[model samples]
Target: MILIKFLFITAILYLGPVVGQQECVKKFMDLSLVKYRAQNIGTESMTGQFMASYTLRVLWEYQFNCSCVNITSLILGINIRRVTDSRRLFPSVQVFTPKGSQYNLVTGSERIIYYTTSNVSTNGMIEYPLDPPIKVTNGDVLAISQPFKKASVVRVYYINGINFSSSMEYHIGSKNIDTSNFLVSNELILVYPVTSGYCVNSTNSITAEFVKKKALEIQRSQPFYYLSQYIYPQIVFSCNGSVTKWIFGAYSMGSLSRPELQIWRQLGPNNYNKIGSSLINATKMIGSNLYEFIPEVPLQFQEGDMFGVYSNNMVNGDSLILYEQRESGPMNLRIGPRLVSPLSTISFLKLYQFTNDYPLVTVEISQSTDLEESSTTEYSGSPYPSQLISKPSQSLSVSAKWLIGGIIGAITIISLASILVLACIIVFIKKRVNLHNSTDYSIIDTRKDDTKKDDTKQDDTLIMNDMTSVTPMQDNSAYGSTHDAAVNENPAYDSYSDGTYLYMSNNLYATVDEVKQDQDDDQYI
Candidate 1:
């Protein structure tokens, strides 16, 4: 009965009010991660997207913890190819305390306790609930690892927008996650994460211009067909720095369609690659105009690098691309020297492929991190642009966090050892005290027995040897003085000849008297 009552009370205490609050919150609030899902609304999840995957795909999202909120679930859209053997895709999610940067996520003492769900069968989106929601505070990183093997293919969406460089990290082959192996792409994953509370909207606005040596030298804007991706191949070794704003022929398809700026770099002669990119929902105007954009994460460019424009929106291709005709014929926008202001340097002079009509474009470059940005609630409305997630300065530094953790761990181990040593000392002291007291008690008891023996013994009597017992004196007269002295001398009178020897030594010729006295005392005492 007692156990039953205790269990009933425990059940009431745990499951009762929590369920009530959850129901209340669910009924009253908009539970969807509507602010983060601003871009994917109305259209298919992967609309205007390029799908790419690696040997090992690991995406780490730096969740902006506006409030101490619980992430209830994630809406994941993964494409799984047919498997031949016993292989299956297992999509999993794990949470981590923000320690080091996302580049070093797999290193050090990691909390790798993962929650795995059943395999996603199709290429559709599914809301995998977090069974028990994972709570997150400010500066926490959420890791999403989709089950993938070499045989299976998973659709990874890549578009333009404000996102971290480490957001879409991939590891190749069976090797561990190395910082160098991560891919920096133009994919801004606005993954929808249902939160139990409100998350701040990520909206960004930047107004900057590209570099221009001469402002008055205007060029004609030419019309060109829009491709999925465009880069300035000829504008290599021109102006190199962080691009703040890019103006391509005053208005390319940028004014007609939404495009993300992709920064491509040339590491060696044949080693050209896309290093960074930005996604923004800049407004499309009616006529020719310049489009302004800002990246959430800062992008750096070298001296021999070029920038490009990308769009995942294949549905709208009737956009304008600014280019020039130096060979006396209409040229392709894929070919460089589009209407961009030149630095008039030796490298810029040798970069232009046309000498005739070329579309004029401008790009602004800055060496400092002083770009002004304004926020908005536009993420909930129009095509969501992008914003940089600012890290807190008040939080512990990476080195400080490591030091404090080491100190705490050392202190814990030392404390446990000290407790064990103290406990052993206490036990030893208790046992020593018990043993000392017992020894004292034994000595005291033995002394008490010796004292009683001394009290019964005569003061002048010297015990030459140990005796079994002493005979008590008689109250009535049983013998003469000689018999009394002889009886007193014998500690125990037995039928032995020691007393006879003593009597003969005291009186040599008194054998008859001694024998008569002994016979009188006892026939065989």
Candidate 2:
């Protein structure tokens, strides 16, 4: 009897928590699982625009009987492509209790229950967590208000083909929302915590395995053509799970006609089949003009499967420009062929993907173990070879080497050009100084020659006067003696052609005979 009692107690102890946990988990799942969601069918259907400084209020009627429920988060379906910067797209979220006839106020008092800000990273439906999760009872009318700031525009999807006869209440910037003809639910999702008991955990506790699949890391080469015609740039990737979302870069000349984006699966080498297509709205583009595509249903791709993007909207011979990497270098693991025509495949395109599992985690985690062993067991033996997903580190190393080489070459060229210019300037200045000195020397030499010529002419004239006066003096001795004496006494006296000897002192003149007589009288005295 003791043994039986012991077994019974042991069984109860083991099964009690397990049974309780299962029940608790179910309750939590029912509570936390998304109850009401406005779904978007395709990218083309999202045409509603929410501008900045305007508050968009969406009314949700609670129909559950859980007594008291916890609101965990809010999921907003937004087109991120319209924003210039995803980081700048901040909108304040508020939960309110609806008032009477006025849809703007929750109650007559307009009481706010919960408030938080949304952090948007990518273009798609994003989940915003609420701190101190809101608690609500049954039959409560809840309003989700999103106030957009200045310069913030969000593209929202609306439920198509539904008519509202004043029963549904929604407001845009203090104005009554009228979807009188068709029913439109601006895709707003509310999240709740499913389990209430200690054994149950919230859904947010579970972490998802994220994988990134990139086509090419580097930009493609030149010879790019503006795709005025239908051109499909496809990227081939092998993923086992469903593709939730995709992002790609594009250049638009802002044509009136909308461009169409299509996805295709590869059946064989160079053969592809269309899966889904969407009309890309140019007005809803974000940073770098990248567009995000989220299908109504997640598209699943098997292992070693190939996918491509077909873009069509070439009006007035407008081309969809693409960068093509022509040179042979390290190719991306997800890189595929550039299908120009039905029979032509010579170039490559740039593309990337986010998968359910890490593409390079296996390659990164198994460096210590043997390559063969690691390849077979790592990350559940990902079908892709390590060489494929492993970032062409070797190629990157080589490319880095080339990049450094190119930089060095550029620096060298600039330095050489600078030195050549400096040298040329120096030579020019030296030549200018030399020419100036030569000019100065020529001027000095010319001045010296002119002075020497003047001196030579003066000496010649004095010699001619002395020779002519010598013959005349010999013919007249007495007169010549008197004249010589007078000339000696009055050194300033001069004999003119009129035969008058004049003595000049300062500005006064006297006869030479008078000057000689005065000199003789002074000698006698």
Per-residue lDDT for 437-518 in model 2, tens only? 4332111234345545433332112222223322222342322332322210010111112111121221121332212112
Residue 405, model 2, lDDT: 51
Which residues of candidate 1, in runs, are more than 4 Å off? 1-62, 80-86, 100-125, 146-150, 153-155, 160-185, 200-525
* Global local distance difference test of model 1: 0.35
- Quality of model 2 by C-alpha lDDT: 0.30
CA lDDT of each candidate?
Answer: 0.35, 0.30
TM-score of each: 0.24, 0.26
Question: Quick one: best lDDT, which candidate?
Answer: 1
Provide the RMSD of all predictions against the true structure, rounded to 1 decimal: 45.4, 47.6
- After TM-score superposition, the amount by which residue 260's alpha carbon in candidate 1 deviates from its true location, in angstroms, is 46
